[model samples]
Target: MPSEAPPTDFSVARIHETVLQMLGAGVLPPVVQAGHPVLRQAAALFDGQLNAEELGQLIHLMRSVMRRAPGVGLAAPQLGIPLQVAVLEDEFDVDPEAAAVRGREPLPFFAMLNPHVRPSGTASVAFYEGCLSVNGLQAAVARPENVEVDFTAPDGTRQQRSFSGWQARIVQHETDHLHGILYLDRAELRSLSNNAEYSARWAQPDIGRARQELGFLPG
Candidate 1:
């Protein structure tokens, strides 16, 4: 007789239950909101203050929290860490047409530490953007479509690369967090909408209509 198959379904359900228990118990650090002082202060560079092992553990925790939030990106300050670190990944599955319109593509998970970005070109695009820190609000903000960034990895390796489209936006957004800049600072105030309203009215990626109807600045 063949050996019995492993109880895969039971294991999976047990893991899910464990996760819910952890969440309810607040085992995860709370994501700091917009008004938190850490979100408004420039984060310090890693500079080897923490040992490599410690830094690795912190990065792992940050990545886990980001995934649990179901967000594409997270910055250290967003978690009140006050270190120049961030992690981002995109599934690019929200809406194919919307993703294409925004030039978003699936990106594997990556971490950036002490990153700096430079615009690759003068051209910029405006889109409705939301932030985990800001919570529930979205607005139109213009940002360069291309950028080159230099950053240190968790392993202390320096790397430089260019990104375009939604990837560039993600890099820029997370980098800004290191400098204590929130998306709302760059957003058109009149374009602000609650997440519910944005889903109901502005979910289609219409920059022109958003500007006209929502009083967003022209891209």
Candidate 2:
């Protein structure tokens, strides 16, 4: 008789267990990874479905989870919510030169609901980006350096803001999630690298060098 096939691994079950653990701890919802159906569907508009109090509570929970993840930004889709919402924050604490080079600066925490963005200028920049949903992989993506966004604030106020550099990139990345887009979909596939390989070979943010070494198009 043929040898028995190797036992099937249940890695997805382990992922579900981790998600349950996070939920049990009263933390934010577990991040849904790539290939999840929810991540691929366009998120619905918030409209008036949630009252101010309900919206506030949701934003608070999202903010808490974002801080716990220690990420610069998080989107509703990442948390398995199909609503157009996101939170972002940044404290520019890197080397002064690096900060200047990347246009990194301190950003107060903010929430965006039903956000939409338009390119503010023709200039574009390419940098390696990783996503919480698409864990353990990074790739170079070219995006407009500046964008103007119209969005609703957490307190039920309409706001429009212009963002550039790293902030612009963060906003674009998160907003894409609302529209069922992933950074990997826009990335230069030739530049894809595992997280460990990225740290070892392309940790520094040098777009030109990355293009040259990784066989990607210039920004």
Candidate 3:
């Protein structure tokens, strides 16, 4: 005998119920609105002189805010402190085709701190960027397709590396956050409004796919 498939309505209802329960439990924080002083202020650099406890506190604060927020990235300024640091997680790996596939690899999680970016290679424009500090808004922005950045690890180890595509964009975006710039500041509002007529897309997601034969899922 075969089992029956679950209904989509039931699935959505269960997810909604879980979210409501979490909200009631105080796992989420009220989103900070636009024009907040912190959101507008430029962050300061990590003094390179923080003790272990101080560094630990910064990390914890960033993690806590990120966990409670819907945005994919956040900066120290959003927390009312101006500091040259930010944290992000790339979680947009939704592929419709993968639903019927046997196996798909997962993307790794990362945290970048005090990152400095240089326009070493190509530049490109990406659209539909939103930020935790600036909620309820998105804009099309132009950025370098590739960049080289230097920074210290969370453990204070110095490191420099080059990145391309989405990685580069994420780094650039966070770097701007440290410099007191929001996505709206660099937004191509005119182009974005007319994007339907003249579309120039950005964002490259499939660089490290475990399988290439799998096609993209329908939107």
Candidate order by TM-score, decreasing, is 1, 2, 3
* Model 1 misplacement above 4 A: 1-26
Top-scoring candidate (lDDT): 2
TM-score, candidate number 1:
0.86
Each candidate structure's TM-score, on Cα atoms with residue i matched to residue i, is 0.86, 0.85, 0.65
Q: For residue 165, give model 3's deviation from the true position in Å.
A: 1.2
lDDT of 1 by residue, 16-76 (tens): 3433443445466768898777777777776765667656766677788888887889997
Candidate ranking under lDDT, highest first, comes to 2, 1, 3
Off by over 4 Å in 3: 1-31, 96-107, 191-219
Cα-lDDT of candidate 1: 0.79
What residue pairs clash in candidate 3, if any at all?
Answer: 43-82, 43-83, 44-82, 44-83, 44-84
- Supply candidate 1's per-residue lDDT for 182: 87
RMSD of candidate 3 to true structure, Å: 15.7
